[model samples]
Target: MTSIYYIQVEDRNSMDGNRSNTLAGLKNNFAGEKEVLVFSNHATEITEKYAQSGVKTTIYQNDAYTIANFDAVLTKLKQIFRSKTDYLLVFDNDSLGSSLGSRIAALLDITFVADAKKITETPNLTVTQDIGATSAKRVIPLAKQAVITFSCNGVAANEPAKVDVSSWSLNEQTKQQYRQAKTAGNGLAFAKVVLAGGKGLGSQQQFKPLMKLAQKLNASVGATKAVTDLGWLSPERMIGISNLTVKPDVYYAFGISGAVQHTSGMNKSKQVIAVNTDPEAPIFKLANYGIVGDANKVISQLNDLL
Candidate 1:
């Protein structure tokens, strides 16, 4: 039977909801034959979560934290290559796991699918690519085995496996190497309520009211790349391509025109509300509710209602 592997950032202790989505998608599609392997710097926390979810197999790196040290990962990959499993699924953040899957496939002389949005097996192996707006699906004949990296938003969460934790070991040299190079800039991913502004806000000065509204709601403030480029807000606060991907419970778009790149990141939000002066802004198409009027005015009125 084929096995699925959910690879995540090692040093980061928190369980990735995105990984959860990928695993969920695999479960929905592959069902019982899948197993999750969590690779992490702090193995205890992540492995415990995996065990709770019933994934019996776990791998830990003694010193592997960042992608720079691929030794431990390579070792783990070699083990997977030896396993009887015919298919391996890898998940990554952005392009972090880009070349890892390809290298493993070459080592094992198996078919490789990089940045795949969807995967299915039939007469041949099929992979889907999510290339902005259009979905590209292709079929590849697998000569030996296959390794694939799932794209963001491609797969939903799978039902967690049922099992107890099993032991695995990592090299001490690799552990020491990672400890020396570890840095603190690795940021946290939060589930926030975001208030985002865009070019329609007119001027940088016009963004203050929006900020105040966000502050009132204790929400994180966000902006489109245009607003950030204009010095209206910091790049850290920007949402969309060249910015952060947020899946907040409530996402408020104040004056954002909703470019596809922008929407691609936040489209997963549970609730989306847009306030724009133009009734025909593309954002309205995705928003659950929309107010077609001056963003500043509508925001002020909503504040009063609050």
Candidate 2:
């Protein structure tokens, strides 16, 4: 299979070192000529790093290419990647990667799979996912061309001889214009500590104390999709299946019911402190420390002590 991995780099000065594993995972999982696509203004570091790590890399740097500008990104991708590969793979942990995979698959009119747990080739490409709370798994045979976003945790990283790098830039302007919104929780992905609230928190005003607590701890604030949809928090702060995924050093889940959608995003946190009114709340299953109490009252007491 001919595969391509798309990685977004927002910071010109730094790159996500963890993505090396994702790139290596792609190379290991599917046998083919795999390439890395670095989408950023400063792609040199990433292109060189991945290229030296044994994957052919291409850099796409355009001034107007922002996360909010989906049309521009899709157009550029169509120009470079459309009909050029057998499989398109992206990281499942981030909103950007997973979202792009689906959109691009639609644009190319190919098979699209999201959040795949495993993929194998017994001479034919097949994907598998565990059925909820069951021993059985769902296996699907993939089409000739497919786009898949999957987890990279268990995949082993490999180092091979460095390859050459290629670059592409847009000299012409795009017809569509976009204004990027300055939303809260942009730092949620890299936050060392996160304070996340769910619908169980009661009301929108309840988040004020959570935000205050986050400020005190120098942590980022996050909200479940239910909270964001109700306007209690910005959509960017949402952490769930179709939103941002984070692996913080410490995660504080406030009043969250611990649904699979929400837990999947933060299950990798080093330490989880969950607060909920229900003693049997599912969040307790994954929490290192569980407190069966009102989330707002706990926040108020913590604020006073801090």
Candidate 3:
């Protein structure tokens, strides 16, 4: 029996971000027995696209947090795995499992593999997960009954998953739980001010001032693709052509070399302020205010003032 590859799409509200290339990397890599289960309140054209791809797609009429009920998605997975030919494959995506999937893996006690960069077929399957932003990786082998989570860092393919759609409604009990658990959120979309950092921030330690600055102004933190790719920041914060497209009232770019791909995401900002040592960085062209200096030093001084 062939092992099943399941891609879980948890939130549909933010689906516009990557609906085109959603899970394309994993689908292209797995290449066999794919199922995309979306737990969302809204339906989009991609559902039909999945059907065209000849994959199995399921949608639940609820958000991901509610779908994570012990008697819900986890129970459904339990039912699927009863056949011994099926398993779960979720990218630790911001849209999907970053947390919900891990909880399910822990609940099921499945041989959960995290951060798998690539999976290879060598008589038996081997999973390679990256440990560092630059090079190091850890390889894991597939098990008969395993639950895997991947980091959606690779470039996803344009082809949508091939699948038919199946819809499920949320239970009343879960609805109450969701209502009680939900809290106030003023996420990046709502942030009037955004203090964005790029790979030029240097290291994880250097990112401290950026965060401190953000807190001072109550601004949200954004990043470039390179920063997210290097594991210094979450893919959720990535501001780029393929990631987040932010239009805050004020957007500040620090240490950002201003790649076109990165700048495009923030070009819509009401006021752009770019800080870079190089006077000729492409980011400066778009900046209403440009400060040509060492980012670390400038940020340090700004933090002191704040």
Give lDDT per model, in order. 0.63, 0.70, 0.64
Ranking by lDDT: 2, 3, 1
**Each prediction's TM-score against the native?**
0.52, 0.53, 0.52
TM-score of candidate 2 versus the correct structure, residues matched by position? 0.53
Report lDDT (Cα) of residue 177, candidate 1: 33
For model 3, residues 239-283, the per-residue Cα lDDT tens digits are: 878877888999999989889999888889999999998998999
The segments of candidate 2 whose C-alpha lies over 4 angstroms from its true place after superposition are: 1-18, 132-135, 154-306
Query: By TM-score, highest first, what's the ranking?
Result: 2, 1, 3
Tell me the tens digit of each residue's lDDT in model 1 across 1-306. 445666654554222212444454555555435666656656564453454343445555443355445555667768855766566656553445666666767777777777676666654556666655665555544443667787533222222545333444554364433332121112212445778889988998887677545534545677888887889876666678666788888999998999988898789999999999889899999999999999988887765543
> What's the true lDDT of residue 143 in model 2?
80
- Evaluated with TM-score, which candidate comes out highest? 2
Task: Please identify which of the two predictions, 1 or 2, would achieve the higher lDDT against the true structure.
Answer: 2
Candidate 1 deviant stretches above 4 angstroms: 13-18, 51-57, 61-68, 83-85, 130-136, 152-160, 163-306
The per-prediction CA RMSD against the true structure, in angstroms, equals 10.9, 11.6, 13.7
